[model samples]
Target: MHRTVFNHGIKLLKPTQRCIPVAVLPTRQSLLLYISNHSLQNRNVSIKTELSGTNVAQPKDANNVAHKQEAPWDIDFTNIVEAYKSKSNYEIFRAAMVFQLCTIGFLVEHGMTISKYMKKVTGKWLFKKSMNMSFYGHFVAGENQDEIRGVVDKLSAHGVGAILDYAVEEDLSEEKAEKLEMDSCKSNVTPEYETMDRYQPHREFSDRRKKVVSARTYFYEGEAKCDDNMNIFLKCIDAVGATTDGGFAAVKLTALGRPQFLLQFSEVLSKGQKLFERFCGKEGNLVDRKFDQLRFETKAAKLGILMSRDESQKWFTWMDRDDSGYVDLLDWNEMIAKHRKFSDLFVVLNPETGDEESLLPKFTDEEEAQMKRMLIRVDALAQRALEKNVRLMIDAEQTYFQPAISRIVMEMMRKFNRKKTVIMNTYQCYLKSAEDNLCTDLALSQREGFHFGLKLVRGAYMEHERERAKQLSYDDPIQPSYEDTNRNYNKLLKIMLEHIKQGGKADVMFASHNEDSVKYALSTIHDLELTPQMQHQVYFGQLLGMCDHITFPLGQAGHRVFKYVPFGPVDEVLPYLHRRAQENRSVLSGSSLERSMLWRELRRRLFKGQIFYKPT
Candidate 1:
């Protein structure tokens, strides 16, 4: 009966319209006759074929073509039954129900907010209960430090790790603000003050006041309050350390100081040679023997000139003593030394610590003492973070301040990274130079023989960075297109993976919402023939409440994964939440691919009649 059915099916098939032999059927006489007849018919059809070459003959075997077309979606019922035989049907059903519920809950909560925010910039109404539930359930493990442990344990059971961020909002205060300023000076002695002063309405007074204020006051009483908060931050790290094996923490550069200040300091250091030439009337070479000797012999004389109440008076006095083309070397040296000392003093003082009197024409000796005290406090904070084994992931801020923070954190990493990845640097993929910067950093890590920890982020400060560049008539640092940034990110990831695979000293965490990048990393690992355990070298990170498709599956498959859970007081976290909502809305609406996946998941659940909710 089966043979008869097969024969009937084959008989229903047709030859091409051009009479090309579609199949070589066996004749009653012999197979050789069938081949000869088929070949001759095909040859004739080829010769008579249209010369335009637009249409090509398609397969004429209806049964074969149907099977070929259906192969992709065809299911083996026997294999499906065997796959489920090992497990109870109820258990399978329950698991499926849970998965659907979680997915639906996630979409409804975040999707609405994303939709609303995408439509309106000032859309406050989107912050509804569903949104909070989605963010809290999917993104946040717990509200405070204590609540994270249960979540951590559950995730660990599923082979996922967590990254804890103590998301504190900036609080402006006279005392705390001043301490932050002073501590910044001690950690980084760049001429940031001068650059920042240039843009301010009261540049001269601000500059003068910063010079006069004591470094200790800047550290202890002013902006240093933010640094002091580090003590509490370290405690949270300790908690995570005790709870989970692969947990990490994060910090921000702005938490330390303003970007303008650091940029100013970098500019001054960069232009040191030019400034030195201007200070010396002639293009005197300090490297020359005569210049060196002159500088050495008249050090006190230079100080005396600088100390003189009037520079004009001192010049006239020098002219009276000796008639020469220029002021005597002795007077010039004295003036230069005094000027140098004053500049040095200005660089050391904390701008934020000054009282009304300190901001006066000149800073008193007492204010200088205050600046020194602030430095000690900052050092203490660094010491605490190191002692606790708390890995500090320093977030990238504006380009201006990033260098200053990098220097400080790199120093800390050198000191503390010996034990573990204590300091992690973040690269903003949107920046054109970020990839180059990362490569340079990797080279430095190789040369220094220290473990390099890096966090790759798409970037957070795009609008601000671009606007500032436009206003200043400078080239924008961001990538020209999204594809460019993704390409760079993947390249960096490959570099990181290579470093890890070789057991070279580097740790990488990919923080992205783009599913393609995540899939690429996974595929790369598989192509490299590395097992899941060995592939733990690469960590997949996503912001809380975004891209569960990548995160959950990789996590379930035993790959190390992390959610960037940010927590702080409600008011402090509002800005961060707002940004999160904006990003979700932008990502969801921007791509039809994402929208389709979301709809697919939604349909799958609805079709199964398993969309009913249960209490968490």
Candidate 2:
């Protein structure tokens, strides 16, 4: 006796013609007893049970393999909690009600104008929302440097340190705009034309010759005027130094002068041979017989002939009695010398140096004295900040201007990073060469004997940089793939970690949002068998209101962490906020998987009663 089930409208039947013993039992227990008896009587007979009415046959091998392949039923949350536990305790203090009140007060005192400006640009409602989201959420630590001491104290209690970056990106003025234009014009002028005589002794006058003086003179005048702005910029550095911690103040290269100067210089150099040829042709054609004969035969030579022979030439000398005077080599040499002198002057004048007399807006002697007094006040404020143990982190800009900024910050780091990391430089890993650049900077720190502090970012200026490169027909500097950039950033982190472990000169601060990157770093720390304190050699940073899962837990766990707090007049900060919003929207639109995960997380939190509903 045997029991069978059929499914999917298929029937199972016993072989009709075969000589096989079969028992039919009306009751379920009797049928089972019969099947057991048949199985016992004949070893060849097999007994089986199946789901009712199912035609599907389950093979023992298949069932066993499937069972073996099933994933584990439980997840390990211990490591996640441990990672979070490793963060500084001070972050918990920041979440307290008292700290929140202090943060509001600080905003009122320092960010009132910024708030007003935001209201004007984004409307009152949006401005209020943004204040809650952007400023209150991310850019601020506490009410003031002193008020933030609670946060610092908390971090310090856990052996973590803080770096301070004062929000002082001021709006560009009309005067500054005009000065930039003039600087741009000067930068376009080439050293070759400025140094070499435009009057070539080898050619006849043409349209090309007519343009030389105006071109060269324009370049010279523009460069000279531009130097004044450079002087002003130098003064700005002094001004920053006077006000902020001398070893912590960061200056942008763009703030000093126009970037177009270098571009213009490059353009001129690119077209150098053609311009030289044109000038040479105009100057060299003096030996043409018609011009020479005409000049010798008549006391008054045709102005056209003379002009054609020496178009724009200030001086010329006769080579033979029969020939028209050739443009003097000595004159050419003098022009070159003068041009070199101008270049030398521009290079030698330190734009960072300025005195009251040089900083203009025509002041009376008393006013000058008062302004100097104000600068002294600025210095006092900076010193106060330093006494509070504030650290400064400088942001990285475009590659072209980065060298200058790097040099400036390195100098500051040498001065301030001695006792603690008071000065930090940024590394943008999205650039193709960023990893290599980081290595180079690390080497520099080692050679110079300075404790290096670095903030690693994925880079913010990718699209703009790429488009500009395309328009300019230059090779794009950004990495083509996100993975490539991410890989490089991680590689850099590994290198930094190795250096730190070896007791070499380096301090690392990671500013990232990618989960993989954060997890990779955590895993690396565990694999290296580094202690929590040794692991504190690195700090994780995230923007406020973003990745709270990582930040909140990490901070709670006892790791060193900080948020970038950008503060300014609302109008001044609008551009930065707008960029952030735009980027977020773009990310959401482009990455469906990420968007889905975020939505799911949000829903789960809402369902679990972990998040309260709030209207934006």
Candidate 3:
């Protein structure tokens, strides 16, 4: 029940019991004129909201309600982005159907994995945001903010004043973080980049296509139990000679770091591959002494001792002093021969005393230099990247060396990625703790004010990692399932986007060919309101000769896209090519978009002419 009052030629509807404003009654104009002194307290507000209509409700003519109002908000996403504006009919049709087929397959796979009720929601997600929404956004808005406020007052004057702002601004805009910067500007002798023996992107003077050339870095073989030390050494030499940035060079400590003192280094080299092969070959003990002599000479050479074949006997006599069935006694003897005490050595020098302080090595300048040279090489490599503006990606390696690699990469990031991204660390998303590590790094970047760049990949050394973990009786470092890895990978992208939004300098080279991941990242960028500069921070990447479906669409959309072109001598890059081939097999199996695209393009070519039809 309501009452109407006419005071000084003005009409107002008041609810009985309490003086509810007639303008909020939601009824058509029954009351009249201006709503005078009705405060919002004890307002007749309900959680139920209506989102339809055309005109803004106004103060009614002696009625409790105003005229019908239009919908609260609208956004024009039809023009927000154009991912396939320039694509041909065949290309467009093929691209569209590929997503559709993929959506169906994804729905079937992911649907079966979720709860029955969630299947419906997830299925809808696949159909919409996962596919349709990614393709286009319809134009939708009418009244602006000022019009909205005016209409709301009109509604209050009549009856209903319950309209919510449809275009909700996220609290994410205009984030102000403490501006972080590089501490010391070291004047590096910038290496002459143009003359470097690397593939140069055809300098696209026009805007038709932005081209990029990237260098491939291979894993290092510094670890004691590494399989390919010779290759690792060769890679290090190449990396040291690199001149500029476009692609990253990969390195591994397992391939590079040799802590022989801790016995952490692989015995493959120390034990002598020749000796192992000969012993396994059982080539008769006719040359057993010769084999022993060769092993001693080789080991002495590796240890950098000036020795000859004649000195093998003397070396063996010195090394076999204790005959403890180990060669480290020679090292201990060498330490003693050089000095009365040892300090600051990486190895535990004092076994008799558990108190480490009692066994500290007396630091000699020469010994310290020798000890640091190994780690200095790592710094030198990263510093070289920094100096030449060549991006360095410290490849994720086996868990044994991953900890040290991660630490060193973080240090490298601190020093190199201070402004631009010279050192982009790799994250193996298949690792269960990758998200945690990403968060930690992102937070560190935010606090320190340095931009962080990341090259994300699914774990490469899973077999090796698991094999070592099992052998060592430890839990595996890999995520439980592919789905888990996928989830983490996508989640990491969103977090990185948020980090970028929150005033952290960040860039990502989205290096996966997974359609779902690529779509999700694009959606994230769009939602975050990509500026031209933000586009630079976000990059889509794939290996050369792969995933053109993802790469081309993203590139066509005016976003930066990079194709990794491995350049090296046949012997040097075969391992890299083979590695990508193995990885691509997995990607192709899960999402056969690339293969499908290739077949379609081939068919299109065949149909267009008797001879090969050129691409439009």
Candidate with best lDDT: 1
What are the per-residue Cα lDDT tens digits for candidate 2 across 1-616? 2212222221111212221111110000000000001002122212122211111111111011111222111222223222223222222222222223323434434344555666788897687565544434343333333334333333323222232223332334335544434444332222322221111111121111121110001121233433443343233233223322222233233333333432322232223322223333444322221223233223122111122233212222322222235322222222221222212111111224421111001122332242233223223322333454434455666554354345445545655566666556888888876864576556656755777888788876666556556655567888998889988888888877778777765667788876667777777765665554456456677553344455544544445554433333344443343333333333332223333434444444457674543211
- Give all candidates' CA lDDT scores: 0.43, 0.39, 0.40
Instruction: State model 2's lDDT.
Output: 0.39
Ten residues in sequence with the least summed lDDT for candidate 3: 23-32
TM-score, one value per model: 0.55, 0.47, 0.45
- What are the per-residue Cα lDDT tens digits for candidate 3 across 54-169? 12222122111111211111112122123222234444454434444334434434332332344366774453333222211110112333333343333333222121212211
lDDT, model 3: 0.40
Q: Show model 3 residue runs off by greater than 4 Å.
A: 1-250, 253-256, 259-371, 568-577, 584-591, 610-612
- Of the two candidates 1 and 2, the one with more favorable TM-score, higher being better, is 1
Candidate 2, position 423, lDDT? 57
> Model 2 segments beyond 4 Å from truth?
1-189, 193-253, 256-389, 411-420, 568-572, 588-616
Provide the lowest-lDDT 10-residue window in model 1. Answer: 25-34
Best TM-score among the predictions, by candidate number: 1
Writing each residue's lDDT as its tens digit, candidate 1 over 1-616 gives: 1111111111101111121111110000000000001112122221111101111121111111111121111222123222222223332343233234434535435543444554365354344333343443344444443444444434333334445444433434445554444443333322233343222222222221122110011122244544454444445444433332333556554433333344443333323323333334444323211223234224324422222224334434432223433333333322222222223211223425531111011222432343223223334444554554445566665555554444445545555566566567788888876765676566556655778878887776666556656666567878888789888888888877877777767767787767677777776665665543345445667654444455555554445566654444443443344444344443342223333445554455457774562212
The all-Cα superposition gives candidate 1 an RMSD in Å to the true structure of 28.8
